[model samples]
Target: MDWDKLRIFHAVAEAGSLTHAGDQLHLSQSAVSRQIRALEESLDTTLFRRHARGLILTEQGELLFEATRSMARRLETTAARIRDSEDEVFGDLRVTTTMGFGALWLAPRLPRLFERYPNLRLELMLEERIVDLPMREADLAIRMKEPSQADLIRRRIMEVRIRLYASRTYVEREGLPRTVEDLVSRRLIVQNPASPQVRAGGEFVQPLVAQANSTLTVNTYFGILQGVIHGVGIGSLPDYITAGFPDLVQVLPGLESAAIPVYLAYVQELRHNKRVCAFRDFVLEEITAHLRTIAPASE
Candidate 1:
């Protein structure tokens, strides 16, 4: 029940080694071990399984760790909220989105964010998995589909399509695929079936992979973009990326998947958090500005 003991336990669980946790806490290993033992005795439950290499969480430890993780996130959110000023947006804001959008769209525009809010500490989590917004796995998320998570404020950003693209050089070298039938003779670059991807993208890529004579599978959209840019082959890519990457040309112009909506979401408790508001505003503004430049050409 002691806050200090919970903090120490959280640190040790995260580090997976008493000595490492002690190093972080600036306490001797013996002192850290004693505290852990005392805490376990108080709880009357073993929290960790001792091993030669390091400790592993027991069932009870896992439950406690989850609780502590939530506690830590809530504390951080509270601290950030308290630190926020109407005049300045400064503090940590963890943002999650798919790897493709993070690497292809968001990452490049981040410099403007830093320029405006120099004190902001931004953590960009680029993965396909949905981070828990209410649980504070991340402060905000830009996702390909509407988030079903409760207790969140959600905004629909825009629609995107998965379509084939190839470099001009590749098209020149291999000739453009006039139809899905034409794709049979050319190498298809796609996200690997094993990798998590948006449903639209998976649908667009699956048929290409099945019909192509040769195929190259990359684990992420970033890798697929690299392959397409380097003249590797035609690829299944998000239509949004074409706005940033000028060299990529849409292949088989008639072919693309149904529109998928992009959404930005945050916990309702963060409604007044300056950092989250700033980021949300910046993203909405950027989308508006870029769509103007991209629309005429994209159409």
Candidate 2:
């Protein structure tokens, strides 16, 4: 019922220790303990079970924590919207994308963003999990497929295909695979089965990896790219990478996977946010530049 008490309870529940929660709330441990006791009295329910290790949430506590967490997320979203100045593209901008694309493509081009808006603070979340943009888990997302989540504005940024590639030196030394069958005699480098990747990439890699006599499997595309660059073996890599690593020769070019659509998405609420607009435009400009650079090679 009391917002202040609810806030304190949420912090304590999250930290699982009164002392730790006190450190975060800038209150004394005894004061935090008193607040928890008062909250329990008001609710007439034990929220936590004490143990030697730490505090564990009771069933009622879990329910209350979930509600409080949702409240926190909503408050954060509101605060972000309020901080978005009409004329200035500044403040925190959280962007989520796959590890490979974030590290390989977006990270390299971020300097241009900072040069334009030095006051902007960017948080890059590179992982495979699809964060909830509408719920404000992340401000924006660059995903391998279109986001099906409602109340979000999404734009198809580009398409990518998983194709076989190897360094020029490796292609010259071992020769290119004339057919998929030829891979049986050569080592193949690929993303491990457990790695989180687009369905197209996974499908393209399995058959080639199956036929190889020797194989090196890495969890991330960045690792697979490294292996290919060092001549470890032929690798299944996204075609976008070729723009940056032009010397990497395509192998069995005819054998490639279906196109994976890449989408840039954000909550509809952020449509007018200057920071969001600036970032969206920046990404489109970069993608256009990349396409132009690779046009001659493709032709």
Candidate 3:
């Protein structure tokens, strides 16, 4: 149970090769191998199975690796906490959100954040998959719905609705659909029904997709937005995007999906982190500004 041996074993298990692990740890391959052997002798267990490709963890090694991974995350959390004890809002902050929102909304406003905190290192993970904040997968998350996870500090940011939109050129050529029934003959551009999306959005588009004469389905809303903007067809897009795209006209203005609530969340452990607080405040301020900008038009 030597801490140094455990550290080496964790690195080797992660790399799956003695030489690669040695390179990462700044130790010679032979030295790393010797340490591994000594650790195995002390534990009286074979931790890995060597093959032509590399080392594969034995069942016992897998269990040990899990523990080490948890330890590593805890150490990182501790380090982050210590760093945050300073008054400066500067350090690595990992934020996760859906690709569409990250690309379409948050990414565009990031310059303002950097202008305020030049030393802040931000890692934006844009993916459909939800990461585990409690496990330290990410420092923060902006999700389409309230998070169900325990020990999370979550706040509803805003509500978005899925509504039909078309570029000016497309509307000029094909004309607007006056009724739900009028949509039957028009080409529809939408997010693929099977893609990871909010339930309200998928439900709103399902009947439209079935009734359309032709369809273009993209997995991401950013792609769907592009298709709609370039005159591909009328598309179902979140209402939040319309302010950024003034040229997009509403199609069937009365028809809209149920509201999808957006939430910002982080683990309770990050409650006092200045970096997290700064980013959260920035997002809230942006949202308030966005709502105000769109208010006059909506009214």
Candidate 4:
């Protein structure tokens, strides 16, 4: 029941040796062994199985280690919250989103955020895997679909669609197609049909890939964008990417995928945290500005 003993047990279990754990804790091996013995006495259970090579946890030790690991994560979260100044926005903020958006949109705009709060540190995780916000896998997430996970505070931020684009140089050389059928004569660049992407994008991509005279398939939208930018071919890319790339000419203005809703979410506990709120506000403002620029006539 002693917190200090539990701490020592955690370290010993992690290190798998009393001597190693002792070195880390600034205690001698004898002292570390004494504490573990006391903890085992209090719990009436063996925590580890000694081996010639090292140590391995017993069944009981695994259970205790699970609790300790959870405790460690929660403690880190608590410490981060405590570090925040209610009136100031500056600290380590982990933000997760799709690779395409992170690389093309959010990452480029982050400099302004830094200018406003020089102390603000950001960890941008760009992946398809949905991070567990409540469990603190990430401090916040910007995802293509609404997060169905629990204990999350979510806001619908924007809508995006897969659309066709090509570099101005390509358009000048190959000429722009006026209709879907017109694309049959041109080289079509797109996301690989096998890659994990939004349903709308995947659906839109299949038909185009099937009929083009020539094709280039990239695994990511970033790769497709590069091909389009460098005049490789007409590429299918998310519309939001165009906000930052003015040189990319929309090949067929009328052709696009159904709108995919984008959501920004965080653990409910972070709703009032200064750094979280500041980052959320900054993103919303940027999204608004982006929407205005992308669809000025609609607005």
The sequence of per-residue lDDT tens digits that candidate 4 reaches over residues 56-173 is: 9999999999999899889988787678656667779999999999999998899999988788888999998888898898999999999999888999998998889999999899
* lDDT tens digits by residue: candidate 2, 152-254: 9999999888888999999889988888889899888888899788888888888777777899999998998999999998888888876789779988867
Which regions of candidate 2 are displaced past 4 Å?
1-87
Candidate 3 lDDT over residue span 64-159, tens digit each? 999999999999987886766555677799999999899999999999999999989999999989899999999999999889989999999999
Give stretches of model 3 more than 4 Å off. 1-87
Q: In order, what lDDT does every prediction score? A: 0.90, 0.91, 0.93, 0.89
- For model 2 the TM-score comes to 0.71
Where does candidate 1 stray beyond 4 Å?
Answer: 1-84
TM-scores of the models, in the given order? 0.71, 0.71, 0.72, 0.71
Q: Candidate 4 has what TM-score?
A: 0.71
Top model number, lDDT: 3
- As a whole number from 0 to 100, the lDDT of residue 27 in candidate 1 is 92
Query: Which ten contiguous residues of candidate 1 have the minimum total lDDT?
Result: 80-89
lDDT of 1 at 16: 99
